[model samples]
Every structure is written in C-alpha cells, then in structure tokens.
Target: MEAYLAWVAIDLVIPNPMNPRRDHSIESEQMQEILRSKGWAEAITCYRKGQYYIILSGHRRWHAAKKMNEKEVPVYIVQAPENNAEELDRLGSIQGGQVDWTPYEWAKYTYDIWKNSGKASYSQLANKLGISQSLVGSRIRVYKFYPRIEIEDKLSNGMYSLSMLDYILKWIKRVEKHHFELYQSMGEELIRKQMLKKYENRCFNSKIAIDNIFVTSACSKDILEFLTDINKKLQDCQFELELLKVDNEVDVTQNKLNVKMIIDEIRLIECRTKNEAGNLKEELNKLLKEIELKENQLFDMVEN
Candidate 1:
C-alpha cells in the first residue's frame, strides 16, 4: 500500500470506528513517562478519511499525546485498502505487531468480517488472513459461545489468559462430543462461564492443570458437580464472613468458656511433674502453630 509520514494535528486524527479495542484508557505510567522524557519513538499509523485521519494503530500513543496536551503528533499515513477484507487484514497486521489484542477481540472482529462478507467459509476466510482454518473455526466458536464484553473486561484485568480460554474451549468441545448427556444437562454456555469463573477464582497458572482435573474422568458428571459444589461453598463462606462482620461480639459466651477451660488446664499442668510439663509445652507449641496457620487462612478468606 502507498504510505507517507506526516505531522498530523491531534484533533484531526480520529480513532477507527471499527477498531476492535474498546478500552481507550490512557497509556501505562511507564509509557507516559517515556513520552514525557523521549517523545514519539514511533509514529501513529493512520489513513486519511475526508477531513480527518482514522487511526489504524498506535492508539495508545495518540491517547498519551492527548493526555499530555500535545498539539501535534507524528503519523504514518497509509493508502486505504480497496475492500473490507483488505482493510481488516491491514488492521490486524499492523495491530498484531503492537499491543496484543485479546482473543475475544480477535474472535469478535473475525466473526464480524466473516458475517459481513456473506458468511464466508472458514477456509476462505483463513486464506485471506493467512491463518489455519482450524484456528479460524475455533475463534468463531469462541465468539459464538462467550459474552464478548464481559470476557474482554475479565481478560483485561490480567487474571485470565487466551491460552486458558483455548484449553477451556477444547474441554467444552470434548465434553459435548464425548459426554453429550452432561453437556445438554449443563448447557455449553453455562459450562464455559463456570469453567472460566472457577479457573480465575482458583488463580490457576497452567491451562493443563485445569484440563487434566476436569477431563480425566470417563464420567464427567462427578467432576462438574464438584466444581458447582465448590462454587456454592465459596459463596457460603463469603456470606458467613459478612455475617460475622455484622456482629463484633459473635459467640462471645462460648469464646469466654473456651478461654476459661484453657486457663484451668494450664493451671493443672503447672502443678504437674517437670517431664509432664515439657511434654505439655511441646504439644501446646504444636497446637499454637496449627491455630496460627488456621487463623491466617481465615484472614485470607475474609480478605478475598
């Protein structure tokens, strides 16, 4: 495509209406600092449209410039592509080299293109994008199954990764194909949502860990039920914690009775033999350690 470099007025440069990125938050602190100290390391990629240039890439840089109140920014203007497919290909190619798009974003836009292009075949669309047909199919499936905005939001928070989603999708398909009855019982959409929620809450780092845990059983009913049970238990635990916070003096009478019992036991131990005292001290130390560990766990649960 024909291209040229120019210094464009910031006001005249507009964000692409079709840009897959929805979160237009300012650049990171580190990136902003870089802009302050060393301005314009790379030019904004754009194309002219009527009175304004639509950004194809470097959107974050444009945002940083606007936040800094810079009047003008460097831009690399390119010739607009002839068709929608070419434009999308150009957009993907340019953005792929910069800040990564989430899988949901990729899938959404890919689906959009596919739909607008008269519902093109996966192989035909893959040929245009120069990716495998299987990948195109999977992405379309992901787009079809997941709520785009919610998944995008969670993914932006860094708790989830595309690789995890990839494996989760595979697991879902395997369940649908191999364990058809269970899939119908739970529904594919619910399965996807629950798996994603459980994976995030548990803070699992490896997709394989989740896959192996869920798919190991020939009968996945038990495993799926166990996941649902864990979710309920976690909700109940959180609810209990909130209830405890409502009553500061909850179980005070019982606590006092337990303390008195402990004190009486200690007094009896004080009057016992030296060897007995040493053994009691050892047991108390171990018990104290165990209590400390349990207390820490409770604190974590409350905080969560």
Candidate 2:
C-alpha cells in the first residue's frame, strides 16, 4: 500500500505507549537542528484516528517539531489497518527495526510483539521483520534481563546497547548464581570495565574470576599500606639501635682514656686526682644508663 504525503497538526500525532524508548533527548536535538536547516524533509509514518493521528514512527521528529513550535508536520499517513493493539504491534515492529532503535529498545519492542502476536504465529512475523526466530529469542533473553536504570543520560543511553546490557544482566545473574558475595555492592560500570580489561588480557574466563580479580585489586591497596607502615617502623627502630651502638663504643673508649690519665696523675702526684677519675666514672655510668633506657624502648616497640 502506498502512503500519501500530507501535513497534520503536530498535537494530533500521539506517541505509542508500547514504544520502549524512554529518552529521545539526543534524537530530538538532532531533529530540531535538521528542522532549522532543512525543515522536516523525511515524513513520519502514521494512521488516522477519528479526529487525530497515531504515530508508528518519528516520535522524535514529532517532539522536535513541537519544540520548534511547528504548527504541522509532514507525514506518510498509512490509512488502512487503523488503530488496534495488533496493528500497533505490527507497525511497532516496523518502528523497532529502524536504525535509531538500540539493542535493548529493539528487544523490548520485539519481545512485546512476540508475546501479543502469539509465539507459534510470530515465526513468520519475525521473518517479515528480517529477523531470525533464534535471534528474536536471544534479543528477548537480553531484554528480560535488562538492568535497573540509574537514569544518567549517557550511562542510561549506552546501557541500551547489546553488550552493556548483556554484561550487566550476566554480572548480576553470575553474582547470584555463583555466590560471589563480596562484589554485590560494586557498581556495574566498574565491574564492566574490569571484565573488559581482564577479557582483553585473557586473564579471566568467567564472571566469578572477574569478581575475584576485582576484590584482589581492591584489597591490594590495604595490603600495600600495611607493608609500608611496617617497613617504616622497622627502619626507625634499626636506626635507634645503630645510634645506641655507636654511643656504647664512644663511652668505652672515653673510659679507657680517663683511666690512663688518672694513672699518669697518680704516678706524678701520688693519687691526688682520684676525685677526677670518680667524676669520669660517674659520667660513663650516666651514658650507660641512657643506652639501657633506649634499648628497653626498642624492645617494648618490638613486643607490641
């Protein structure tokens, strides 16, 4: 059937509720820019309701035209097979196959059509959409495991692709299935990065291995800090021990010199300088006590 080109009021073309696409911000902006430079050249597809129109495609263009305050939009109005759930499903599949639909978006739409169109009957429908039955099944598997949206624009948009969504789904399932308890709170993006890195390095074969590697990387920080602290303390103690050893050698040498001087003074003045020798002995005792105190402190540190 040939679609006739015509202009319709932008408000009359309603967005489909069955459409799984949540964010059209990027597309809308691009459309608005295109409208400014070239106007709405590519027509949106739609079908007539009694007083309004229902969109099968170009919801983003419709929205962008409205934002531009355009009174009407160019459309390819499919007049037949009008407004029913089944018809919506058919056109929706048509819409889903467009280049703009991300993997999750495609899967979500296909999964819906697959459910409502009846499973046994959807094989032909799948072929009509240029998609294989098993491919549709894989897409449905990807769709059913869709992750919770944190609603950040880029993250949320990127998550709709097959790889990211599949990783997140598998990550969560693997965590639960394999009992990787330590990684339950890790962010999806971080774990995804770790998986990609390990996969590239060929170091990890499974999600469990990925989780173990991530935990090891995380704990390596604490391990490094503990080692650093122990090394510093040991170095400080060794320096003190060396300092005390040097002090002990100086004390012994000084005492020997003092005793020799006292013997020379006794030989010349008949033991007149005995008090000087006693004073030198007292100084040596003080130095020895200081060394003993320092050694005790080092011992205490080691025991603790």
Candidate 3:
C-alpha cells in the first residue's frame, strides 16, 4: 500500500455509508464549530482500491470540514492489499496510532475490525496496540457492559481513565438488576453517608479518649448528676465568700460573737464532776497569778 498526501478530488468515492467510524456526535459538533470559526476545513483520511475510508483520528475536524461543504479534504491514500486480512491488519495499525480514539474506543474498533475481517486474534491486537492481553480483555468487557452515553461523555471530557471506567463498569454490572436511577442514587448516597459517619465517629472517639486521658472520665448517665452536685457546692461557697467580701467589718464582728457563743455552749454542755471543774478553775487561777506577778514587776521598774 502507498501512503501519500492527496487533495479531495482525486477520483475517490466515499464508501460504506454505514461505516461505524462515521457515527460522530460530540466530537463532530466541536470540530464543525472550530472549522467554521477558523476556516481550516481540510481533514485527513485513508483511500484504497477506489474507495475512500475515513479513519477518524480527528473526527470532529472531518465532520466540520464536511459540514462546510468543502469540495475536497486532504487525505493519505493506502493502496488496497491482496487479501482482506492484510487490509484489516493495515487498518488496525493505522487506527492504533490515531489520536482522539481512547483505549476503550480502540479496543471496540479493533474488536469490530477483527471480528469482521476474521483474521486478527486478541493477542495480536494487544501486541499491535502495545497493551496487555488482560487489559485488552478488560476493555472489551467494559465495551460490552458500560453505558454508551456515560462512556462517550467520559471519553470526551477526558475523565474516562481505564481504571475509573473499569470501576464504573464493575459497579454497574453488579447493580444491573436494580433500577438505574435508584442504584446510582443509592450508591452515591451510601458512599457519602458512609464517609461522613466514619469521620464523625473517629472524631468523637478521639475526643472521648483524649478527655479520659487528660480531663475526667464519666459515663454519660452519671455526667449530668456529677456536674450538678459540683455546681451546687461551688455556688454555696461563692455565696458565702460574696457575703464576707460585702461586709468585712460585719464578718469580723460575727466571728468574735461566734467564738463567745461557742464558749457559752461548751459551758452549758459540761458533764464533768465538781472536782474536775475545780481542777480547771485552779489552772485558770494559776494562770492569772502568773500574769499578775509579771505586771507587778513591770510597774516596780517604771516607778523606780
């Protein structure tokens, strides 16, 4: 096959109107807008054996160029091979290097080509694409199960990484028996609530453990009772202190009266015999005698 650039009017016919590659919606619209704005309506494709095949590397650009009604789009021609197998192999190689086609896209496209051409194996396709057989298998699996609209949106938005797509496909398949919206909403809500509850419980447990270590430990049932008792005692002590502060002179007077009242009460409650009371009286008399002696000595010095 020869590969060379050629103009649009090179005796080529647009073949296979039902070509799978021609189904462009998201990328095509963007391409058309861009070309209309920039006036760069030229695009590239592959031509072979009197048939023009559009290999959508830049599918949007091709669509835009077509929309502009441009008579001729630039292309690279590959001469037809001897057999269908060689032709498909050539097409797969060309598609393998094409841009805008993701791994999933390439996987689907390659699978279709091989299935149609009846010549390519999964291993061969994986080798040609420089991907693992398992990965190729996974891509094929996802292509079979994934929602087309979701996959297309993700692919266009650059959010469709292989791992994420794999996860989404697995999640969808697991919940396939359920209603789509119900399953989606339930999954999302469950994830959100689960994460939220996990963090909240962690924070609460950490706080409780810390408080037990550094502050005080109490059961939830006993905490209110303990706090109430402590608060009451504190309030009573505060009230007494406030009264004392408000009248310092009255506080002193009241303390003296309290001392006298305590002495009178002790005397009234005496249960000692007359002999014991006499012994106490004699001790008081001795103390008074000592005080008198000291006073007399002090007076004599002053007089002299």
Top-scoring candidate (lDDT): 1
lDDT of 2 by residue, 1-304 (tens): 6779888888887876667676655567877998899966789888776877777788788888888888888888875463344775656666755646655566767777766666545567568567777667667666665342422233344523454444445644554444344344444454444444433343323343244323233233332232234222323333455676689899989988986886686466422488977886786689679769978997998999
Estimated TM-score for each candidate: 0.57, 0.49, 0.41
lDDT of 3 by residue, 1-304 (tens): 5578776652343532323353645466667777668765444556554445544234455555666677766776656556645555655565455545555566566556556556456788678667887777667666665556546555656645555455434433333333344446556445333322333233222222122211122222232232224222323333444565569878778978986985786577553699888887787689679769978997998998
Any runs in candidate 1 off by more than 4 Å, and if so which? 116-119, 123-132, 153-191, 201-227, 231-304
Superposed on all Cα atoms, the candidates' RMSDs to the truth, in angstroms, are 18.3, 16.5, 24.6
Q: Which residue runs does candidate 3 get wrong by more than 4 Å?
A: 1-6, 10-43, 49-61, 81-88, 113-122, 158-161, 164-304
Poorly placed runs, candidate 2 (over 4 Å): 1-3, 80-98, 121-126, 132-134, 147-304
The whole-model lDDT of each prediction reads 0.74, 0.60, 0.52
Colliding residue pairs in candidate 1: none
Task: Note the residue pairs that clash in candidate 2.
Answer: none
Count of clashing residue pairs in every prediction? 0, 0, 0
Q: Kindly indicate the candidate among 1 and 2 with the higher TM-score.
A: 1
Q: What lDDT is reached at residue 73 by model 3?
A: 66
Model 2: how far is 152 from its true place, Å?
Answer: 9.7
